[model samples]
Target: MGERILIAFNRTRERTVAAKTRVADTPASRAVGLLGRDGLGPEEGLWIVPCAMIHTVGMRFPIDVLFLDREGRVRRVISDLKPWRLSPWVWAAHSVLELAGGTLRGSVQAGDRIEFDG
Candidate 1:
């Protein structure tokens, strides 16, 4: 809840994936990710490091999930995942990026590189 970091997806020709992304690097932060929140904005996202699978057990809205490797390259992408849905386990993923529903519908794709900007 402090300062947010900017994120960009290199493979997308339309727009940036997320303009303000919050890093959930800690266990506590990762565990409480996006739960009980109203909704995710178009330009907001959550980056969960060291994560491969996630369950939207108590989520209020749908979201787009991207599984990425250690180098910030996307390995898999799930768009418009409804609440209570469970994501498939991506063995090659070193992290997970959660964003607003339909965020990656026609924008992002697998193998795209992601970067954090100041």
Candidate 2:
């Protein structure tokens, strides 16, 4: 597990969807990202900083991925990516958000601003 935090997506019309998030900022933490976990919970997520790509080779299930820019704005979204898939490199991405499959398909979108809470 990583450092617990709170994340909220500011969607259109001031709608925000919040979730319990974790930060994977260390090399060790980023290397071991969700590799050994059974699955992510409904509101649980992992945030990897300074990452532009990801792989699910060692994962047990599918996941939703969000590529965020420096200001926490969404740059791209990969929904329900199954295990063993490779994500495309996002040059503008400053971080990556990992969550349970189907978690953000209908709630989050590209260009949405995300806010972090302690």
Candidate 3:
């Protein structure tokens, strides 16, 4: 796991989506994201910085992805992204949040704002 942080969704009444989000800011951490992990906990997530795309080539489970811009505004959301799949490049995104599958169904969406707290 990386540095733990809290993720809050501002648009949804300041709801806390992820309370144990990890930061993957380094090259090594980003490349090895979620690999070898069985699955993510209910409130667990990974935040990859300076990323525009992601893949689950050898992953064992599905996830929900949030593409965020520099100001922490969500540009796109991909839900239930299964293993062995690749995500489309988000040109305006500056980071990405990978959460457990079904986590974003009604709690988050595109155009939302995200807040990170250490």
Best candidate per TM-score, number? 3
The clash numbers for all candidates, in the given order, read 0, 0, 0
Order of models, best lDDT first: 3, 1, 2
Show pairs that collide, candidate 2.
none
Q: Tens digit of lDDT per residue, candidate 3, span 1-118? A: 5465766555545788888898889998899999999999988999999899999999999999999999989999999999999999999999999999998787787888898886
* Model 3 spans with C-alpha error above 4 angstroms: 8-12
lDDT value for model 2: 0.85
The total number of steric clashes, by the backbone 3 Å criterion, in model 2 comes to: 0
Measured against the true structure, the TM-scores of the candidates, in listed sequence, are 0.90, 0.89, 0.92
Model 2 TM-score relative to the real fold: 0.89
Best by lDDT: 3
All candidates' lDDT scores?
A: 0.86, 0.85, 0.89
Ranked by TM-score, the better of candidates 2 and 3 is: 3
